[model samples]
Target chain A: GAGVSQSPRYKVAKRGQDVALRCDPISGHVSLFWYQQALGQGPEFLTYFQNEAQLDKSGLPSDRFFAERPEGSVSTLKIQRTQQEDSAVYLCASSLRTRVEQFFGPGTRLTVL
Target chain B: GESVGLHLPTLSVQEGDNSIINCAYSNSASDYFIWYKQESGKGPQFIIDIRSNMDKRQGQRVTVLLNKTVKHLSLQIAATQPGDSAVYFCAEKSPGGGATNKLIFGTGTLLAVQP
Candidate 1:
């Protein structure tokens, strides 16, 4: 794709269920990032990946949140035992290089019931 | 609209008028700065960006002004339109520069264009 692509534009998960969201970055992009945006809030940083290496996971709110970019091109965010507070728009972005402008995906709106 | 804590102060402008949004970043060591526009229920879309070395950068119909002294940033949009109505965010990625990235962002500001 010419741009970053994310799956399941909208996801509805029952509390305590596990959900996984996927991101496909632009081809050969070396940097990928995950962010969580709450209603009426700015997107908060989650984790960052340089190719297949996870360099930062400090922004993750809980241990239940996990992310992996096995090949550096595609990534996934998994939330285990979801809670209502976890509901938000999960965004994925990729940049040709870091510190440059990043391309953002459409984002997945996750709603926990 | 509800305001986010990290969000920048908002500016309301009339259609065909100019709109200005501002940001104050806490990190002075931050080397790169960017602006993003996000509509409701969507992710942020790239706006324009300026590096610390430069005081100004411009894009079509948009301009970015940076002041290192006060650690402030601003986005200027000429002839604001209804299509320009959305939340604007300012992001900073610091000295650990390269593809290894993390952007600390401001909360965002909602630009309301009155016709």
Candidate 2:
């Protein structure tokens, strides 16, 4: 209810299956982010965390794309073999620092069938 | 490989008029600038932020303008309504110690609101 919540909003993966996306921020909100939206393009930066410490992932576009925030408020963005350009929409944001202003969720479309 | 542009991708306003969205950035040691509003499936809603030493910034009705010597950035929505439509992004951040603040998005400008 505070904000930032995501999980299985819609996933169809099958190409090479292996998908796990979940984010639940907005509690302590140190900092957590993962973005990748490509249906019209906008969000990109696909990795960042400051609480559970992940630092950066160079924008993960390969290596099967993986993300974790362990306990800093919850975060996980896995996508093993899935293809089809890895489908689209997959976002999760939260900020209380890093210059501030950020709180989002409602994203997780990923469809690679 | 840095980009964030929009000479215009789509912008049709009418409701109450007054809407200007344009952004062009290529990093000049960017120092924070944001304006987002996406509504379709939801996400991105910040809507105003400016700092590169601040050229202008006003919220609520929305307003953010940062020039940073020509890097350019703008977003102003006064009366435009129809829920203000959606898809409008312009973000950038760089110039810090870095643990990865990374925010560099732009390439969005679909704000069709006519009523």
Candidate 3:
């Protein structure tokens, strides 16, 4: 597949539980971004990574949210002590360069019960 | 607290008719803009893009018009089809976000193409 991939496609976790979502970006992509999309709203930026460097995370909603791309090819977003408010579709996008067009993944729908 | 936003929340059009979606941005420094379409259960797919320097750009059956003076942007779809039913969003790249070119997305407009 030439496009970005994410898993698991759907996740349901109890409140206060911790969950981790993974994103596999397009090969050789230099920039990867994470976004959160609530129902009826456009995706909101959460964080960004340039290879292994986390250049910005200004959009992260809370300290409980964490993301890492240790190898720079694959990234993971972890939410600790999840709350109902954390439920949303988590989207991942990749671009060949910074500030250019990006390709997005199908996104992982996370449901906090 | 500048942000991108859309004028309409939903738009319905008959097949073969044209469709238009509009957006507004508060940041004048945004140098790039893009439009994305998201079908049910799918991620947003890029439709078209226009640089701040240009007023209009066209793709397949889509056209993007930029009004820098008013900070407004619009996407026009020709001969709307059933496949065109989706939520459309407009995004602007923030100039101050360094090389990352962080994109700020607007509230999307749901386009419903009816037969």
Candidate 4:
């Protein structure tokens, strides 16, 4: 079975540019989560979705950050006006409906210069 | 503001030796704990998990122990291998939220296996 996967394993963007990171969760997974991991640090929760509904966006750092999961399958994390501070690895995870055990993706590393 | 943290920044052990990684959490109300292994250039991979109800749980070659009385958690790996060398992190379920599934992760401990 295929695990969660993210696209554009590496990305380099100029400051103030917009970037979109995509995640494909496992088939039939009902829960999806996004996290940000800075260098030498653990991942921090960013947002969460249950099916197509966005349930929690509390962890998003700023208004420039946005996420959506329409059709209950694929999710996207978009960062507008990228900043140097936003340079980090963005990780996506999925789990069976509301379960605590989450399967993670390889993550997309975004480097803002 | 509760947080999770590791006791050591790095641990080096010989291959085939037993390895133990320690973690401390601030929230006593946290009930669920998990261990994850992350290699360079990859996301976290689940190793094992234990709930507050159980003091200990085991998986293939890996074991997790939870001490609720002291708000401590530990991961034990038997007969460590080079493939097991990576960053290990302990995570706890968020205590008070409608979205309790969100996890609070600790600063990872790097496990270096020397053959």
Ordered by TM-score, highest first, the candidates read: 4, 3, 1, 2
Residues B1-115 of candidate 4: C-alpha lDDT, one tens digit per residue: 8899999999999999999999999999998988999999999999999989999998999989988889999999999999999999999889974664989999999999999
Candidate 3 lDDT over A36-106, as tens digits, reads: 99988989989999999999999999999999999999999999999999999999999987448889999
The top-ranked prediction according to lDDT is: 4
Model 1 TM-score on a 0 to 1 scale: 0.92
Q: How far off is residue A76 in model 1, in Å?
A: 0.8
Instruction: State the C-alpha lDDT per candidate.
Output: 0.86, 0.85, 0.94, 0.95
Ten contiguous residues minimizing lDDT sum, candidate 3 chain A: A94-103
lDDT of 2 by residue, B21-61 (tens): 99998868877878888999988888778878888988888
Model 2 scores a C-alpha lDDT of 0.85
How much is A105 displaced in model 3, in angstroms? 0.4
Interface RMSD list for the candidates: 1.2, 10.0, 0.7, 0.8
Tens digit of per-residue lDDT, candidate 1, span B33-102 = 8899999877799999898999999999999999889888889999999999999998887455344567
lDDT (10s digit) by residue, model 4, range A1-113: 99999998999999999999999999988999999999999999999999999999999999999999989999999999999999999999999885798999999999999
TM-score of each: 0.92, 0.34, 0.98, 0.98
Query: Per-prediction DockQ, in order?
Result: 0.75, 0.31, 0.84, 0.84
Model 1 alpha-carbon drift over 4 Å, by segment: B1-8, B95-99
As for DockQ, the candidate ahead, 1 or 4, is: 4
